[model samples]
Structures are given as C-alpha cells and as structure tokens.
Target: MMSFISRTVAACLCLVLLGCVAGQPERLAIDPRYDSVAPALQVYMERVRTGGERNAVLNWEEAGLAALELGDTDTARSAFDEALLRIESVFSDTEAAAKARSVWYAESIKDFKGEPYERAMAFFYRGLVDMWDGDYENARAMFKSGLQQDAFAEEQQNRSDFALHMFMIGWCCQMLGDYTAADEAYGQLREFRPDFATPSRDDNALVILETGGAPQKYAAGLEMSELRFRRGATQGVSRVDVRGLPAYPMEDIYWQASTRGGREVDRIVRGKAEFKVVQESVGKVMTQAGTAVMASGMRKDARKETKYVGAALTLIGISQMVMAANVDARVDARFWRNLPNRIHVVTTHVPCAATLPVVFRDGSGSVVQGGATTVRLLPAGNGFLGRATFLSSLLYGQ
Candidate 1:
C-alpha cells in the first residue's frame, strides 16, 4: 500500500515537470530585406517567419493584406496559400493538437486555424490574387470556397450570409462569359441582399472598396477562455461615392467575425476551469479532514485503522492539489489582425476611361477631409477592375 502511494506521487511530479518543459515554441530570425516594407506589414512578416507553423495562419493573414496593398502579388499569393492550406488541413489528429487537449497544455499551443470568418477572408484575398492575374475561373472558385467557409458558422442562421462573396462570384462568372452562372449567383445575392444593385451585363468596370480597420479580439469569462470581439468603429467614413457609377454596401467583416455562435474551445476551456476549481476545493476539504483524523490518531485512545486512513487521505489530497496547479485554462487570443472592417463594391458601364473621382462621407453626409481619390480603372480584357483601401486608424487619427 505504501509503495502504491509513493508511485502515484512520483508519477504526478513527473507529469508536472513534463507539462512545464514540453511544447516550448522555436523562434526564427527575420531577414533584413523585409525591413524596407511598410512598418505594419513588416511586423506581420516577421511574425510569420518567427512564429513558424504555430501562428502561420494568423500572421499570414496580416501579411497577405499588407502585401496586396503594396502590389506585391507574389508575397500575397504565398501568404494566402500558406494560410489557406493550414486552415483546410486536418490538425486534430496531429500530436500537437492532441497535447493541446490535455488540461496541462494551453489550447493556443496547437496550430492555429483561426475563426471561420478569418478563414473565409483568406479565401477572399486568395480569390483577389486570382483576379489580379486575370484567372476568372479560379477566382470564381475561390469566392465559392470562401462562401463555403462562411457556411461553417456555429449559428445556422448566420451561416452562408456573407454577401460579398456572392456578389464577387457573380462578377467572376460574368467575366468568364458564363451568363447563366452569373445570373444564378446574382439571383442568390438578390435574395439576401436586396440593397445591392444588380450589375448590368454591359457594365465593364468593377471597383472594390475595403474600408475601416480590423475587429479587435479579446478573451472573456473567469478563466479568460471565452473568445469575444470588439467591432471596429467606422471613424467618420460611412458612405462612399464613385462618380458615374453605382456603389453598394457589400459586407461588414465585424458582423461575420462576431456572429459565429460558439467555438468548441469554449466548452473545453470552461471544463478545464471548472475542473481546476473542483480539484482545489475538494483537495482542501480532504486535507483538512485527514489532518483532523491524524491528530485524533496521535491521541492515546486512537486506533491503528484511523492512522492508516488519515495517511491515505492526506496523500490523495496532495496529489489533487498538484494536479490543480498544473491546469491551464487560458484562451487563445491570437487573431488575424489588420483586416478591413467592411467591404464595398462599385460598378459602371464600359468606355469609362477617365480617372473617376471617389468621395467618402460621414454619417451626416459631410465630406471627410482628405478622404477622396481619383481611381483609374485597369483594363481586364473587355472590362476593368479597380481597388481602393481605407485604414481609418491611419485616416482619422485613431
């Protein structure tokens, strides 16, 4: 009996040591050439290189967007491809994932796949990279895949509600000269998003506008295990106008980010938290009771049976206390930061060669200071594509 108790205590101590030493992440050095890139983008690139596979998805997301803004299609394509590949892969069966499930490990120790919306946005950017290359068929497929990702939301009602992908799917179909498929895609958009004006077959220019800042992520609950998002404020840029073109509000990213019902991590984290509390509470009770029994046994009148029971109970209590100390219940707050808050689209008929003026207005219809630009439509065979990105943090001094 004494041998068994000694073995159990030794095993618990070993586990505690193994849990503390295992899964220490490796850090890599960043190349100096990336130093010349934009500061925000440089940081993401460094994280992508430094954090390695564990945080590949999160860092690549920021890096991809930043690369796109700099017109570095090669880097953007690489970033999105790396992120999407990991996002689509099955990580649950891997060793790291298995370890992460243990109470001794943090969920963040597993390779991050990101929230559904973040995964969807990776597809969105990958699709845009295809569009930039004039590969309409692949671009259409990418948009459809993005919609599929959005369909995986925990709440069924919120699933498949990303209107931007549907609209872009229609545009890609139209570009490919598949009028029937184009109409079908547009029809679906019309069903859910009636506010968006349907594009005419004759229209040859598509303007995509990305505005505002990324949603902020934070952990909630007693153990900081519940994932939550704080929607980014628009900061005075509410409405956008393109001369001689019709513009529409396509999608709000914050809506997609927050609407996903719940994560499986939520339950696991909550369970770990509760388990820790129970272990600690029960351990204290057992220890106190055992101490009392042992004290009584020390008295002249106590029997040998009481002394044995006290020793066993005290050992069990100590083991439980040790287990409780090793429990890790903190949430993974890593996110795809720097994503735009909202996405908007503008369309116009062909022969629109002139550089068209774009205006940004606040909620009260007042023009935002310095919030205007002239965008020249780039020729896309029979049509054209234009892009405009706004970072309100940089624009409005946020």
Candidate 2:
C-alpha cells in the first residue's frame, strides 16, 4: 500500500500533466484536401469566432492569406486590418502586471506575435490590395506605414534595413509620377543593396513573383539528462532556419543631384538576399524543465518503498516523456504562405492592349509548368496597370 506522501506526489504529477494540457493554445483542424481553400478558410474563421481575442488575431491572419489566395481582395483587406489591430492591442499593453505575466507565460499560451519582417510584410500586402483596387494614395500610405514599422524595429532591435520596403516606396512614387521622390527612394535602396537594379522610365508594369512556403518548425536534437538538468542546461528546444528568396534584375539610371533639389539618386540598382532567425523555441525548454521538476518531486516522495518506488519513478518518467513528445513544440506554422519567397522585377515597355506573359521558374531555372500567367495591359495615365487573366493563380499559385 502506498504511503500518504507517495499518493499525494502521484496525484500532483497527474495534475501537472492536466494543467499543461489545459493551458495549451487552441489549434484548428487541418483539411485533408490540400488544394481546397474553402475548408481551410472555414476552420480558421471558426477558430477566430470562438477562440477569443488572441485567437482571433492569429486566425484572422490565416483567413487573410486564404482570402488573398482566393482573389477576394476585400475580404483579405478586412481580415488583415482586424489582425493588425488585435496584435497591436495585445502587445502594446504597458501595465506592470501585464508585462510580468507576459514575461513568464505569454508565448506558451498564445500565438506567435510575428517577427519584424512578418509584421512589415503585412503592411506591404495591404498596400498591394489597395493598389489592385486602384487606390494609389492609400497604397502609398500603407507602404509608408510599413517603412515606419521597419524604422521602429531598427530602433528597438537593431535589425538590418529592409531593402524590399525601400524598393516598394520607390515603385509607389514612380507610379504616382513623383520622379523626385521615386529617385530618392531608389537611391536609398541602392545604399542597402549595392547591386539592386532600378526600373526604367519606359517600363509600364510591375510583376511580383512569390514562390515556395516558409520553413516549417519541428522538435529535434533534444539533449535532456539528469546531469544536464542539474547543471541548469535548457538546450532541448526548437530552432528554425533563415528562409528567404533569391534576388533578380533591375535597370541602371543616373540622376543629377541638382535636378531634384540636390537630392542625389545613385547610379546603380543592386539585388538583396538577406535572412535572419525570426523566432526561437524557448517555450519548449521551459516545458521540459517544468516536467522534470515534477518528476523529481515524485521520485523523492517514493524513496521509502524500494520496489514501489522504482515503479512510481518509472511511471513518472514515462508520463513526462510522453507528454514532452506530444507537446507541439512546432512554432505556429501559420504564415502568409502564398506570398512569394522572392520578388523579381523587370523593366520593359508593354504596348497598349498587349498581353504580357509572366513566367515563374524555380532556383534551377526550369519553368514551373503551370506557373505562367498573362496580364492584359490597361493604360493608366502615362503608365500601365495589368489586369491579370489568372490573377489568383498568379498571386497565390495553383
């Protein structure tokens, strides 16, 4: 028969497992049909509706990506708007208690708040939505907002400058016919990426290419031993690689400093290929430590009965191992999956009413067979905006 202390220890161990399970963040069910967009959207929307504010933010991000894939720009815009707003509300809290709780518990209980690049890309996508709607002014505003966010990130984290955002700013100015502003933006982009290519004055349309999904997270290479744990080692956690797209071409231009109020535009455009470690899996380490501590307590309590103590210790150890294996240490794999892995720009004049063929190729230079789309040029003022024949497939992939 078990002693009072052993019984209490076993009960407490069981409770610890239950508490961890209960505290886990809710997750949406995956759809079996990989190509079906509606079911995915439905699951995400349901999570948002029933999962409270934090869940709403995460699910809204998924919903926005799905809507973008489906060519429902309006829905995408609304979802992204709500997501950005909710993220701000949660992370912007300045209360002392909230800060303390966040430090201890925020990451393990909720969704990923996104890294600087991801957050800045949200604004870029919003700007694209506005551009598709012919709202150039708002599009420009969104791009500017993205730049501001990048600046904030640089100030707070000392992150590298985002050349992509700078290029977008120049592109927006070029579309707006503000040559002076466009030149200045392009000049800044050159400073970041010395080999970046600038668009020609004669080029009419911009083709943005997104390819491949972001890297998925998984648990691997865990080193958990009693000695290591005793030594305060928390090395059993998740890690991710720096995933980014390759760079492509642009044209060269020379601008006189005196022409644009002494604002010098650089003579070259350069390609940028940069990546960084976005999120770490410290939560897994914490979870592992917590489980170990509980198991240690149970073992200490069962010390009196040799045979029963071995059994009790074995049970505790097995339970914790199982729990750790089951814990989804995979960082929230949810991301704007449809966005291009890399963006390519080309400068060419499209004749009025011409159909511009856009082809996509992988890193090996072979064509993604079904990845070609045609854009019908519609003259807008002195330039052109394309009406993609298969816009959905072009933007999100088949």
Candidate 3:
C-alpha cells in the first residue's frame, strides 16, 4: 500500500510538471515565437537581483508577462505596480528593451476610469469565476469593469468579447432579481454585435434558458483568453503617458487620528450648493442656487475637479421641490467613493464682487474638526469656494 501511495504521489508530481496540476485550470501557454526569448529573460531577471542594477522597469514587463501566462493576477498586479513605481527611474535609465517595455507598462494602468489591459483580463476571469460560482452581482461589476479596462485590447481582437462578457452580466443579473438591468445589458449587447438577434418570439427555449438554469450555463473564459492572447500579439501598444493624474497613493499615507483635519487625507472633493448669499454683510445681499452632491478625488498631485451633478432629485408628494439644506449641514466630497459634497456655489449676484462665506466639511456634518483651509477661486458653475472641510463634506452628504 505504501509503495502504491508513493507511485501515486510521483504520478501527480509528473502531471504537475507537465502543466496538468489537479484543480488548477489549464493556463494559456507562451507563443512559440517566445521560446527563445523566455530563457534569456529568466537569466536577465536573476542578474538584476544579484550584482547588476535592478532593472525594475524591464523586470516589471517581464514579470507581468510571465504572471499573465500562468494566469496569476496578484503577481501580475504586483509586477505592474513595480513598473509604475519605477516610471521616473525608467525615464532616466538606459535599456535596449525600454521602448517595448514602455508599451506594456502603459497598457497596464489607468485612472479611476479603468485599469490596464492585462489586468482587465484578470478582472474578466475573476468575473467568469464568480459567474461559475453563481455570484452574479459580484460577477456583473467585475465584467463591467473588465470591459472598461480592456477596451479595444489588441488581445480582444475587436470581436466584441464585450458582447459575450455582457451576456454573462445579463445572465448573472437575471439570476439576481435584477431582470430590468439584465434586459438593459441585453439591449446594449445588440449594439456591440449587430448580427446577434434575439431568439424569435415563438422560440421559448432562449427565455427558458436565461430565466432558468441549465446547471450553471457554459462560460467562454477560455475562448476569451485565447482571443485576447491573439489580440495582444497583433495589437501595437504605443506608450500613453500618464494623462491627467494617477490615483492618490494611499499606501504612503500614514494615518494617526489627529485633532487637526488639515491632516492631509488621501483626497478631497469640494462642491458648491447653488445657494446665493441670501444675506451677507450690509453691502452684500445676493442670490445663489446650490447643487447637492458627493464626489471623490485622488491626492496624488493634490488634485481637485468639479462635476455638474444636479442635486439629489426626489419626488415629494408628487410635486418637485428642492430638498431642504442638509439640516446636518454636511456633504462628502473629495475621494472617489461618494457623491461629491454640495459645493457652496454662492454666485455673486452681489455686484460687490465680494467673497461669500464658504464652508467645507469632511464626511460627517460636523465642521471639519480643525484646520487651515486654502481654496482656489471657484470657477464658473460653482459659486463660492468653501475652504472648510466641514462645509465641503456637507455639500455632498446630507
């Protein structure tokens, strides 16, 4: 029996070595064209960690490339993270592969709008896994975000992997009691592949299949991976400079509760309510209208921006009337997590051109505990620039 167990263990090890590890999905393989390139890359990687200067940039590309082949996302994310970290250094370094390295690097990251291509694939697969596991809501968000990141990926082959991905979203949404959203996703899918027509009205099978399970419908993830791999090879990735700004570096932030709100949080959003100064000093009586909202921003480059989101609209007693000022006097702005705080937009209907009292807030309605507030001039749309954290928080929140 012991000898038999030994033989079984050896057999398992052999299979793993042959890339057939039990319970692990068969991963995409490196192309034959890369056969020569792979070994040379392996050698180069070792040199960097020992005596040679760390080619962090090239290593990023190489590591990402390898991790992607093995379908290892966390590793890929770390590799890209390192590459982005070395951007400034990369600019100063000299390497024969820099041009090619830059291409993969740029294709790997994006701002709040989305993520890079390979990461998008990771998200796509994660969504696929979620779908397989019957977690539709989580799957929907993942697949949606994956498309946002992997838009036009050379790997996606312009074949509307997007359409197929959304089909999964619709499937999951249908399972999650969100049939309306599922139908909408199905509708948008037609826009991607005009050739895809809904089953004939008399064909009841399609409806039955979507509404009822045929034991967790088939997933096209492998096909997706293959199509994407083909696209990546064919796509020409030109390096896109980090446009606008990157997300705030939360890792660098050292948070120790301080009484001073000036405590440089990771980000801030300052919005203006369209309320004009009803009564200012003796000389300034002006009209203003405020918009209520919540917004988020990144602290990298210490950024700020505005959006014209109409106040939180509602139907009250079947009549339309603006909601009263947040009695708590707070809104959440600055930080991509929430609707922006109400920016106190006190347009100087005041001919005096005098500054209006602008208040800012943190998330809570309380005035930003304590701090020195500096505000830029409020541009068109937003009236007064509220420098206080408390007032800014209230604008978007309550």
Among the numbered candidates, top lDDT falls to 1
All candidates in order of TM-score, best leading: 1, 2, 3
List residue ranges in candidate 3 displaced over 4 A.
1-118, 152-161, 195-398
What TM-scores do the predictions have? 0.84, 0.57, 0.25
Given candidate 1, what's the lDDT at residue 41? 67
Model 1 stretches with alpha carbons more than 4 Å out: 1-24, 27-40, 244-246, 291-315, 350-354, 392-398
Per-residue alpha-carbon lDDT of model 3 for 132-171, expressed as tens digits? Answer: 3445677688768655643533343442344545655665
Weakest 10 consecutive residues of candidate 2 by summed lDDT: 267-276
lDDT of 2 by residue, 75-191 (tens): 778878876775455444445224223322222234444444456667777777777766667777777776665554424333335566677778778888888999999998898
What TM-score would you give candidate 2 relative to the actual structure? Answer: 0.57
Best by TM-score: 1
lDDT of 1: 0.80
Return whichever of 1 and 3 wins on lDDT: 1
Model 2, stretches more than 4 Å misplaced? Answer: 1-40, 50-52, 90-106, 152-160, 217-338, 351-355, 362-364, 375-398
Question: What tens-digit string does per-residue lDDT give for candidate 1 at 24-45?
Answer: 5676444566566666566667
Report lDDT (CA) for all predictions: 0.80, 0.49, 0.32
